[model samples]
Target: MKAVHFGAGNIGRGFVGLLLHEAGCEVVFSDVAESLVQQLQQADSFTVTTVGQHPTTTVVEGFRALNSDQDPETLTEEIASADIVTTAVGARILRFVAPSIAAGIAARPAGAPPLAVMACENAINATDLLEQEIRANYQGEDLEEKALFANTAVDRIVPVQAEGAGLDVTVEDFFEWAVERGPFGGNEPDVPGITWVDDLAPYIERKLFTVNTGHATTAWHGWAAGHATIAEAIRDPAVAIEVETVLAETSSLLSARHGFSEDDMASYRAKVLGRFANTALPDPVERVGRGPLRKLSREDRIIGPAAALAERGLEHEGLLSAVAAALAFTPEGDEEVDRLQDLLRTTSADAATLEITGLAPDHPLHPEVRALIAARITGP
Candidate 1:
């Protein structure tokens, strides 16, 4: 078996590529980073170190790399005959990669087994977004016959690599790659790392609301409290209290909407918090809190659950606090953070609230968000 995986970064190499290699598939990494692509092309192998309770290292080999920017034809050819195509690229990047995938699908010969494509991104239904982009780019008939797209929920914490750690990744031991089974018709890729589920919505929500939400909340609150790393922030009693409060609010929404048992959510919440507090990971607050605007979106980690909770007349103050902190995140290099700061400075409170969170004026959570933005704009 062969797989074409996009985004040869830490999550792609450490989690997704490692699992694909273990599944006995020859992995082809398609990346636009010239240096990274050249490194993979020249190197024989790389290591993935899983840190935490059971620390172990595995060497990944028998993989090929292509510079998707300079060698599109090669990548398209690789995708044409590939059995599986997966991406760890951010949700926003799927559009850029879609045309190549569409070209690959068009190049496939008749009667070929449908290529299984999954986007292992943090966002909800990321593969669906990829599929939409591919559909827009594809000119061939019977698009469904050429590719099978499955939405996935992936959870793995990959911290910034130490300097000079060439192609090597250090990630937390805990990882989950849950894929929807209904899309594959029982012929899912032979990836042992996957937990195939009949319904992926609950898993997606559970991970997004708990892991993503808690992680971002910790980062934002941690930044506000003058903390550096996630471990440091989560260990701080004040930050921890705020994060737990946000998780509690999201937990209630999950239980109320998804029918996830209270006990189950509590266990999940505890495990997630413990992961954040893992000193071994040392995820930086700036890195996690970089995309403040996206995190504050109406359907994203903070606002999504908060909006739902508000609609149900549930308490969402904790989430709103996180939102306020998110607005205060002003990291140096993040484009989103720069844009967010600009919006806050130049735009009106109501306009900025609607623009940032995509919340309508009549939304149940609108007034609170607007008020927060107004406070942020006016200052103390």
Candidate 2:
């Protein structure tokens, strides 16, 4: 079996690529970074270090890399013949990869076996969105017959590796990729470590609201509190309380929305906090909280649940507090932070809230965001 995986970054290699290799598939990495492509081409394999509890090392071999921009034709060929295709590119980069995927599908031999295309992004329904973009370019092709696009929710804490680690990805051992299997027509991909579900909503919301929400809350609060790393901040009693409080709000929403047992959700919350406190991972607060604008968007972690809860008249003050902390984050190196800061600095909080979160001015939660922004700027 062969897999064509996009994004040669840490999560791409450490989590997705490693699992694909272990599933007995030869992996072909497609990346736009020339330097990374050259590095992968030079080295036949790379190391994935699993941190936390029992630390272990796994060497991923029999893989190749192609520069998606410099060599699109070759990448298209690989994708055309791939047994499975997966993407770990950030949600924003989904469209850029779509054209290549479309060309691959267009060039594929008629009546060829179905190709499984799953996007392992952090966002909800990511592969569905990817397929939508691909269809825009590969019109007239019956994608349902040619490929299976599976929406997936991936959860893993692959921190920024130590500088000069040289292709060795350091990641936490805990990971999950819940995929929607209804579109597979009973011939799901043979990849291991994937939990296939008929309805992915419960799993997606569970992971998103718990893992992602908790991580972002810790990052934003931790950054505002001057803690540099997730482990350090999670260790602090105050930051930990904020994280738990936010998780409690999200848990309520998830339980009400998905019928999850309160006990199970509580267990999940505890496990997530333990993952954050994994000293071996050591994720920087700024890196985790880099994209403040996207994080605050209506469909994203913070405002998504908060807005939903507000509609149901449920408690969401914890989420609002985390949103305030995220607004205060202006990490030095992140370009998006500067953009977000400028927007808030120049415009009224209400205007910025509308533009950033995609919330209507008349939204029930709009006033809440405005109030939080005011509180955040004024302090206490």
- Candidates' C-alpha lDDT: 0.92, 0.88
Cα displacement (Å) at residue 89, model 1: 1.1
Model 2 TM-score, all chains together: 0.97
lDDT by residue (69-175, candidate 2, tens digit) is 99988998998898899999888899999999988887778899888899998887989899999999986547778888889989889999898999999999898
Whole-model alpha-carbon lDDT for candidate 1: 0.92
Candidate 1 segments whose C-alpha is farther than 4 A from its true place:
378-380
For residues 123-154, could you state the per-residue lDDT of candidate 1 as single tens digits?
Answer: 88999999999999998787889999999999
> How well does candidate 1 score on lDDT at residue 320?
92
> How much is 25 displaced in model 2, in angstroms?
1.2
Candidate 2 stretches greater than 4 Å from native: 374-380
Q: lDDT (0-100) at residue 79 of candidate 2?
A: 89
Quality of model 2 by C-alpha lDDT: 0.88
